[model samples]
Target chain A: MPNQDEIFTWVHTAVEAGANVAFALSGLLAGIRKQLDVVGICVVMGLAAFGGGTLRDVLLDRRPFFWVDHPGWLWVLIGTAVAAIYLLRTTHYEFTERAIQWPDALGLGLFTASGTQLALAAGTPALPAVLMGVISATFGGILRDVVCNEIPTALRDRRPYAVCAFVGGWVYVFAVRFEVPPATGFLLAAGSATGLRAAAL
Target chain B: MPNQDEIFTWVHTAVEAGANVAFALSGLLAGIRKQLDVVGICVVMGLAAFGGGTLRDVLLDRRPFFWVDHPGWLWVLIGTAVAAIYLLRTTHYEFTERAIQWPDALGLGLFTASGTQLALAAGTPALPAVLMGVISATFGGILRDVVCNEIPTALRDRRPYAVCAFVGGWVYVFAVRFEVPPATGFLLAAGSATGLRAAAL
Candidate 1:
């Protein structure tokens, strides 16, 4: 049987990967709406997928960026973007846009939890670490929309997007502070954020 | 008498300080245009002034941050913002906006050159180093506008802003490659970018 640490690592990686895919899908949809070329779409996808994590790493002074550490994820992103472009061509924009919300909420939870955990591990103070989680969970979409010349939905949308991340980050921090079991604490944090976002939607 | 390296450090610090003020001033103008409150104005000012260098430092894994290293500069920024707010309230909007161009252009040059030089110092490759210069020169203003919900002037302006930075970065790179004296090379790069941007304006 795998150790708790091993299981946490696997689950963490998978969740982040799924979250990345959700963000990349949103980028693809944005690119398609903007009528961007293939290169533009890829660029947007990369920014949308990695911007938050990159910002978090920078804030924490971490090395080997998330995308750099997982080079295969780049290929995965490209494949997802290409496949998505084809699949969504016939889909209604309204439905496609709404469909992205589910995974985006998942992304909100997992990214917030992971980003907070990373910050705590790095020995950052609580409030700033929680801010890091929010930044990690939201900055990618902000970058995408800003690049596309639209107001960032994270900032402008009425729904409680960043609030979910904020709550999730605090949950993780409190869990760690209280010595909750690591994996369970992580899951609880993520679940709260995802559930909150889903409820808001 | 100070050594050559000592002179370089002094000159670099002064130029960067001046550039930071210029960016903060632009941020003030932006905040006033958007009618932000006092705290909002200060937040925008900080983001506009430090966003680029912070981004570059993060990319290069360099620390302590420029503002952090010079804690006095934070006071300077607040003072400048407050004083400018009082001074500009009586001035014509058109005049204040145009007056900002001179310093903004100067910032573009110095920031581009310094960012590239820093990248080179970090052992980054040539092309990537030049790109870093462009990012350093441009990204702050981009963040400022994005936060303000306006399209980034860096992206939309027909003027030759980033192009000047690109050229300036190459000038610095080539100067270093060919064994030019450091101070002269730095000035040459800055002058080229400033002149180019001024001409475009």
Candidate 2:
């Protein structure tokens, strides 16, 4: 079996890449809805993609932030943002308010699982680990809404956003405790979160 | 002379205590103006008091956030917030829009100098350290404004808010480089930033 360090590296890289794309799309749609300028769009996109993980790293005392270490991910985020803007501008497919929920839910589920696992790896207890998952999943949207000058939908909307993440994170922790394969545990967590969020919609 | 660790501890504790009180006051006044509920008031006060420092620690990979290490500061922040709310409600002293500027500027100046110094201690180069200072000083207010669903005053107010903090940080850095006492350097930096912001107002 690979060492703990290898496992951490694998988990961090995979989740970060997936969540970055998902959150970037959400941010791009939100920015377009707000009619922000190009620079503003990029700023919001970057924040949405990176803000949650950045907060997690900070709280965990992890250094040399993920984006800073892999500058290529930033390029990927920018490329996705630019392409999204082009598609929206050229096509008749308008980004309806409801369309953002899909990407947001995807990013939320992915980040929730990843953050919970990371906290567990860092030796945090179970409950705080779950809380970490919620923060990682929800904070990016909160920041995005705040930047857009709106009350964070997470706080204002009575929906089950953070609740889905919290339940999914607990599922992962229990699965891991029961000797579930690490990859399978991740899938279970993400799938549960995404399924619940989609159902809520 | 004290060792580097000793110096860091002294600076971190002193600046943290002072900035906490100042920013807590600013946040309390802001919450009262906005008419947030008690829980909302506490959250804003905590964020204003700790947001910038938390950001800096995350960037620098510092562990066990200052407030986490010394929970006493949380009490201080809470006490200040509660008192401010009580005073605003009981006294005829209306919290005019202008009252916020004083505590905000004071917190900005103190946090700017302390953040710059901490970054230097973390071995960050001069320019990035200056930027960190500006971030530490201004981000709390930005977060507060954003949470309140207003455009950040630092971004909106054509006034030289961040600029003042930047200049003050540089002054502190240069003073330390020229063999000034650490305390004196801090004073110089805080005074310069507060004076500049007050003058701009």
Candidate 3:
């Protein structure tokens, strides 16, 4: 198990990787849909990265949030967007189709688990915790879709994306209540969510 | 001069126009910046149209904001966006530049007034009222800029847009306190905000 600093670093890396993948996928969708230019692609990608977290922070009345304080997220997003365009030019749709599902699931899992943990730490009740889990996991995609002028995949007649988040949140809650180590509980919850999402996809 | 219903009709017309113009401009900007696609443009426009009110409603804890209830605004934004593409294509940069200042000021005025009124009606303090006024007038544009990967124009070292909103809100409060007719007072406040913004521009 990692120390606190190591854990934070790992989480940040995972989140950044997740964000980059999601943004790249969103940009792909935007490009295919003819809803964006290169700049628009980057914009959509950035929204896919930060939109959920921003909304969650604003709603929870949290100050500064991660993006506001650590402005490096902006550069990360910009770099990822540029990389995505270059990668997309050479890569085929089949490549993305095969490549995206795992990381997307991982993103869903990690974001949901973190969201649930944050809400519980902030003293929100269980229901709100689960809701935040889903929100944190899915809202960036939702915002991306909305900006792309498409229905949110979570809100549409899609597979069980939010359900995975909801279930994972409950798992974390139970794990904490049973006095499991925080790291173990978070990892278990995130793993469960990712597994569920991957299976659905 | 008009009855309440008539006033609402005018208000509705102006709101529809303002909302469309705001979205259309944002879309155009996104296109020029080469940052968005068709869906991306539409999203930018829709968010630009509805984001301000949604933010205000969410902050004030008002449920089922007007956009969520009235889907007509969505259609309005769509129409405006489509119309704007061609209109913008034909229009010269200088003409577009000249056209934007007044509408922006008008939107600021109307949105600030409505936001202030809603906050007061919701029983928030006076300070929050002014904040909401600025939020309602400018946050949509801010969100648009942020998503488009640009610094929010409102936060830039430019004209005192939010300043007009803050001062205009106070002007509204004084007018109401002085028992001025609501319509007259509203017009006066909105007019003052517009004038201030125009002068600053």
Best prediction by DockQ: 2
Q: Give one digit per residue, the lDDT tens place, for model 2 in A54-95.
A: 878779766788789999988887787788778877988776
C-alpha positional error of residue A77 in candidate 1 after TM-score superposition, expressed in Å:
2.2
Local error of candidate 1 at residue B6 (angstroms)? 20
Cα RMSD of predicted structure 1? 6.8
Which is superior by lDDT, 1 or 2?
1
| lDDT score for residue B164 of model 3 | 84
CA lDDT, candidate 2, residue B198: 92
Error of 3 at A195 (Å): 1.0
Could you report the Cα RMSD, in angstroms, for every candidate shown?
Answer: 6.8, 7.2, 11.9
Better of 1 and 2 by TM-score: 1
Sort the candidates on DockQ, descending order: 2, 1, 3
What TM-score should be assigned to candidate 2?
A: 0.59
Which candidate would rank higher by DockQ, 1 or 3?
Answer: 1
Report the lDDT tens digits of candidate 2 across residue range B69-130.
Answer: 66666667756767776786788876654766676777778888988988999999998998
Better of 2 and 3 by TM-score: 2
Would you give me the overall lDDT of model 1? 0.84
lDDT against the true structure, each candidate: 0.84, 0.79, 0.73
